[model samples]
Target: MTTAQKRSDVPHAALIQMTSGIDPQRNLATIEEALGEAAAQGAAMAFLPEMSVLLDRDRERSSHHISLESGEAWLRAMQDFARRHGIWLHTGSKPLLASDGRRRLNRSHVIAADGSLRAHYDKIHMFDVDLPTGEKWVESAAFLGGEQICVVDTPLGRLGLSICFDVRFPELYRRLVEEGAELLAVPAAFTVPTGEAHWHILLRARAIETGCHILATAQEGQHEDGRATYGHSIAINPWGSILMEIEGGESDEKDYRLALVPIDPVATKKARTAIPLSRSRAARNITL
Candidate 1:
């Protein structure tokens, strides 16, 4: 008789970058094409950027069209694609209206190779900021905050989920690591100013501190609504090293791109062993 496989044997993963528009169909097609390319490049798992289906800059328009029932189309498409390609897929944040009629949740979904929904994470932190460069975002004004942090077990390893602005909080990553997360996902639609200043440093710090691989998929270039986003989607190792970075240039505008990255739990352990910061922190916290 054949034996059942263990959970720790999954393969390499990929992250997809999307410059989404107000049209859901266009966004779906763009992501589908990117997934096919990533699969061809030997990715066993892939992740999409936040707001992967639509980037409606207008608040009222987003609120008007965002529906949980109607949003099933995107999820169904992702599930079907994962099943057909035999890979795990992570759909980045979507705005789902709550039953209260007062707030919407920014949520993400993970699908297994068999087309099953493995887990879902509602972004706990809302992007409420007024940048020094005269740009402003008040996400809390339109969206409700999530109360729980979500971590999921995958074939590759345990993954802790967070969205754009959540990356700024170190406590969340520490808690996730305490929960035994070996991989972290930070899907974002970061603005050019902040991303240029803090993106790489913050992501690298999270990877180094938590001793986990970080899969960060980001939106690139200016949107149809005249809002600009920083690109350069990246995958980082536990030791704060960059594995693969999807580069964006001044005039380049292709956002439907995919980068295949290999993540090994064994390698992560070795990297952590070299420094042992997480261990040292634990030791220091102990009272004599």
Candidate 2:
């Protein structure tokens, strides 16, 4: 049996929904407060939204804060923080120097309870589009796309990591499921338009498709950089049921919400066994 099938622990995961500003220090403080609260509330793990460290659209101003040196320092600090709390931390995503060191990469880090780096995934799909609201995002112009799929074992079971725009692609989740992901994390900073239009449907579809719990922490409301995000941070079960949801609003420091939801590996097993989509697809030699 796979690791996911053998596990039966249901750990409570804390999802921190924030309206991160341009200040990395301020963002870090917010995360620290939320993590402290989550730990006090008995959460085994905590998740942050994309750009949790810094959310600046202006590359010129953001460049100073997003260096490889600064990113590493932030990771080290967070590692120590997680060690203190004794809770696993999935830092949604942060802006860091790419492998080439010329452009940036949207990277997610998974830190274990013991303060060890377990796995990290760079966002492979870049958001480059023009919407009806006249908002155009050209992520590729500044950030290099990653070329990997990352899944790792944790106390919560096998976790698949993806960021923001990666949710639009179904194949990634399929691959993650095939690799034995019992839970999927899609940390995002989604614009209001797309988040209203597609966020819940897309997440529910992925959960139902993969038979894995979906944990999506998101940036909400208007940011300091002038961009607005749709903030409805949510957790869905393998059966496509909404486990917990925190709605969005005006950016307020006091309004940052932490939602605690139990993640059960048994639910993943039950859903997959009942539907048997994975087995059916494999039996039919499905490929794309």
Candidate 3:
């Protein structure tokens, strides 16, 4: 416990970039190591990349490993790990087996230092797209969309939670701001091609548009299942300035890294007042 905790109620949060594989056990081990290092470095909170629990190539086989959020052993281990470290843990995204057992839910969960569940967010937007490179994804086939937006308060600030693909839609984030979000968290397993094109722009834009600090955890490198992800975990201030980025090459598909930054509430307020994008839009009238 560092009294750095009382500094304007903002604390150091670490963003982890990982490359998860089909084996949940191995992924869990890797996460434990990474989190241990983060805790040792004096981080009060840590953000894990989306699907950091597991990534598989076979869509049907993945269902076997996906577990419901409440009763999953792996998720429990994650919670215990957080409590042991005395640090807030943001489990980016995991596959929660739906009650119907026909599909899964791409969900994110927040764990307090005491290991209690603070909030959980299911990803509303599905990544369904076809690329010219002959790659395609119909995410809706494997996972159902989430209906609600999630925001929660902690030592850091009020956080707006979202998974990958949700970042592309600005409306959801605007709604989050209206709900008093001071930070935006994006956990993603983004494809390399799309990451190269849209990763930085989409994240920075979200921070600027809402005047909130952004913590985006990511997966990088080619996985055992043959999926290649873009890995550049980043932190940005309310002013949309890049506070810190993990040391990684654009093609560092197998490299794991971390980015840590301090969040300041006053900076968010200042940026909101200076830009006022939301206020300006609210005052305008549109005719179609």
Candidate 4:
């Protein structure tokens, strides 16, 4: 594993909230504008929302229209921006066509300021659900699930990687904490119904359980394709407190915004000093 440069004790990070559409070019433009704003606001690291490149509910269109190569433009732009601004860029999940033509993977990337790829994580859990509101998702039909849990060494600290639905599984977050992760990134384009119901609870639970800061960049409002997403993008501390959240917004507002949240390693250490819950779990006895 490549060692990440140690940054200062207090690091500032920003989460970029956006509602993407079917047009990849337009999405790239929006991401560029958001990153620029984040850099100007003195964010040491910036995160983008899930489906950052494109968001189409139609399985056929999503599978056939988007390609991994299509994301090259956005990746290059973000790399240059990160290098120029001297900040880390966490580009949220982009649809990548797997070697097997049958499925695509929702992949998230962490890029260093020197324009090197630090790590990439394919989303392990797929959002396959049937909702009562006539809204349904069959992510398994279009996307393949990732097998390995990913954790990356970062300038600020070790970061655990996860996408939207993966947040529902507490075990994954626990595994990441065991591997020395101090922060967790949950980039999501959550549906209106589910986001409203469980988003805050799940995020806070993961943060408290792992004793890590949670940075969740999300899609808020309605997309051009007429899909409504829950748009309260937030950053939560290890103690399960919300540091910042974007509250009121219309369904289609394209706001390029950034929030600087302070992350303290000492605070995380202090929170875990008592019982060492994560370690105790590893040593627990189980009956077969």
Q: What TM-score against the true fold does each predicted structure earn?
A: 0.91, 0.94, 0.92, 0.90
TM-score of the candidate numbered 1?
0.91
In model 2, the clashing pairs are: none
Candidate 4: stretches off by over 4 Å: 1-9, 59-65, 69-71, 250-254, 286-288
- Write model 2 residue lDDT over 58-141, tens digit each, in one string: 989987887774546788888888998889999999999976878998999999989999999999999999999898999999
Ranking of predictions according to lDDT: 2, 3, 1, 4
lDDT of 2 at 262: 82
Candidate 3: pairs in clash = 221-253, 221-254
lDDT of candidates 1 onward, in order: 0.83, 0.88, 0.85, 0.81
- Per-residue lDDT tens digits of candidate 1, residues 1-288? 111122335477787877888888788888777777767767778899999887887878776667763555778888898888778888988777776876788889999988999989889888888899999899888888888888899877999999989999999998888788899999999999999999999999999988899999998887886788998889898988888888875443544776677777796788778888777877899632
Point out the higher-scoring one by TM-score: 2 or 3. 2
RMSD of 4: 4.8
Candidate 2: residue 125 Cα off by (Å) = 0.2
- Model 1 per-residue lDDT at 245: 89
Badly placed stretches (over 4 Å) of model 2 are 1-9, 69-71, 250-255
